[model samples]
Target: MNLADIPLRPGGAELLPVRGVRARQAFDNRDWVAVEIPVALEFNGIAHAVMLATPTDLADFALGFALSEGILLARGELYGIEEEYGPEGITLKLEVASAAFARLKERRRSMAGRTGCGLCGTESLAHVSRALPALPPGPSLSKSAVARGMRELASLQVLQKVTGAVHAAAWCTAEGEALLVREDVGRHNALDKLVGALAKSTLAASTGFIAVTSRASFEMVQKTVAAGVPLLAAVSASTSMATAVAQETGLTLAGFVRGDDLVIYTHPGRLNGQPATA
Candidate 1:
């Protein structure tokens, strides 16, 4: 369906005025663009990191960032979250347990004005690979389940279909039903949002796998491991670092997942059954 027919939901896409030319015809058009803005995450009133992301789901984004970055070990460590919006952007004021805050100060990792995903503003290479947690003995997804999950994930991207400029991360059951989905301009941001959502929900996320509409990066693998999910299936190829980390962490990583056609980068055993065309 066209944008004209789509009813804008909460935190929906923005329409920008622009000129269009097609088939030697020039006309005025309003293009749909995903919202991208600078979001600052502050803990205990101390400035932490600034990232460009969609303004929606700031709460989930903040909590997810804290968990994935290993800043706060448990959600209970986060006491409260408040939002302050201004002309500059949104600032997330997070009140955390004193212990967690102290640890954060010790690390002194500041990512102000960071845009895309990566270990930006990290103080040292040693901080590149944080200690990963032991994953649960998760349910294995069959080849068919992975294919079905991708199909469900692709169809559930309401925001992407409207703006066509965002990545989505989906949490799917072993049977391939997409139970949860989150979208953002940045792929890692999407995954982080999904992680946070899972934490907030009552769902037993360990029974499912993660499917992303972007390539598998090392940080992505790390986040998946931290989320305690067993597998990460991406739409594109996996990076060397991502593959290595997955192999080391016992996380199943799959890339180039288009229907039944896919490449299992590491721990192929996680794909429970034989493959076939979807």
Candidate 2:
């Protein structure tokens, strides 16, 4: 799948305004563009979730959804994927192995029982804090790297710059360059898309830390762990449970990542320097 072809329409360009009076006009032209597309994730023949997102690198979205939801162990575990656009939404048929299908079914059943119904599963506080696998070990990033990553994150979000309605997830190298970026209306979906893209491209998941233009929540950390990434950076704050899960999972969670400032809740050692590439 060509990532280039996914975001079919060029939203706009990144040209700066002329100085003084032109800046005011720049503000006038700054209207958010809304692109709503339906993303249907189907496991085998059963549909899992239907999301409203901006149409972009969907293959990454599929891979990320599977891995983040614990549907697939790794990119290699995903057997085949096909994208078909229908009148209602874009359906992604992800073919998983039988073993994976069984696990997905079990997950759905568990979720159903928790909410007392398959259709209306409301996650309670207890259910929100789920078990996480051990985090992969990596090199510690320097303070400079973290600072650079946060500063560069905003520039990577193409959709958010246009729509102001999308959230973005970026993969920044240990040194500070923003590499892969994914944007969606849902922060989790954005992160999933980034994870999936990293798996499908030259992007490395283990070494560099991830940054998001949204709050760091428990589910966010869960997705990071599922990708085997060692560190996560967020522009906003995190919940208490999120910090707990990060500590337990051995992930370095950093929140409120702005220029020269960050709050480290767990595994500060991992953020000291860039992690070794896995």
Candidate 3:
């Protein structure tokens, strides 16, 4: 299926343009609409969780979800992912070997149907702020690279361009060259897709900086660290908790990365030049 053909805002009302005075003109009025879809993710024979996603990158979504949730150690452990489409919705059947299943059982202790929510089964503030392993130190990215990466990220977001309703995450090297890009309605999902693509390409994520078109949330920092990427650049602001996580994980977090200016939240040493005193 054409990526462009997929609805930008899934489950939203059809966009019918009003005819204008110009004979060949075509445009639709901007409107905000909620997107909801049934995405049932089944593990082995047990139904794990059903979510509502924009349904563009279900494979990436499945793989990323498995990795982020600690359901699988690596991509190799996942045998296969099959999407079963029916009248009800899309059911993602993820097949894994017994070893991975065993590991998942140990990692995830709860089974109370906290299905659709991204941060599922977390009962307390402590769980909400789980620890992430420290990121290995990587090469510092140039100022120009950071700026170019953010601009390239915007161009790669086809869904967001059409609907203005999605976020994008991209990776680039220290020399202003973008490598991979992923888009999703949720910022975390976009990062996950980028990570999954990075894994698939067998690229050394350590050599590049991860750029996101969303606010730097704690999970965003956590996911970047989990991918072993040391640098994260976001187009929007970062929460205080997110900065703390970045600092703890030894990841360089840059926020408000628009055209020319950016705010370095932590690890300013990753910038090409010397740290700027604010």
Model 1 ranges off by over 4 Å: 1-12, 113-115, 273-278
RMSD of each: 5.1, 6.8, 5.5
Clashing pairs in 1: none
Number of backbone collisions per candidate, in order?
Answer: 0, 8, 0
Write candidate 2's Cα lDDT for 200-245 as tens digits. Answer: 8776677788988888887888888878778889989988977888
**32-99, model 3: which lDDT tens digit per residue?**
43243567777886677665556667788788777766677788988999988766567889998888
Q: For each candidate, what TM-score against the reference? A: 0.92, 0.81, 0.81
lDDT of 1 at 270: 68
Candidate topping TM-score: 1
Task: State candidate 3's TM-score.
Answer: 0.81
TM-score of 2: 0.81
By lDDT, who's the top model here? Answer: 1
- Report lDDT (CA) for all predictions: 0.84, 0.74, 0.74
**Which scores better on lDDT, 1 or 2?**
1
Candidate 1 structure quality by residue, lDDT tens digits, 1-278: 34234333348478878797899999998988887777889999899888888877878888988989888888889999999877666788999999999989978777754436667788888878877865655466788899999999999999999999999999999899999999999888888899888888888877889999999999999999998888899999999999988888788899999979999988876685422111
**Residue 275's C-alpha lDDT in candidate 1?**
22
Q: Which regions of candidate 2 deviate over 4 angstroms?
A: 1-32, 109-130, 273-278
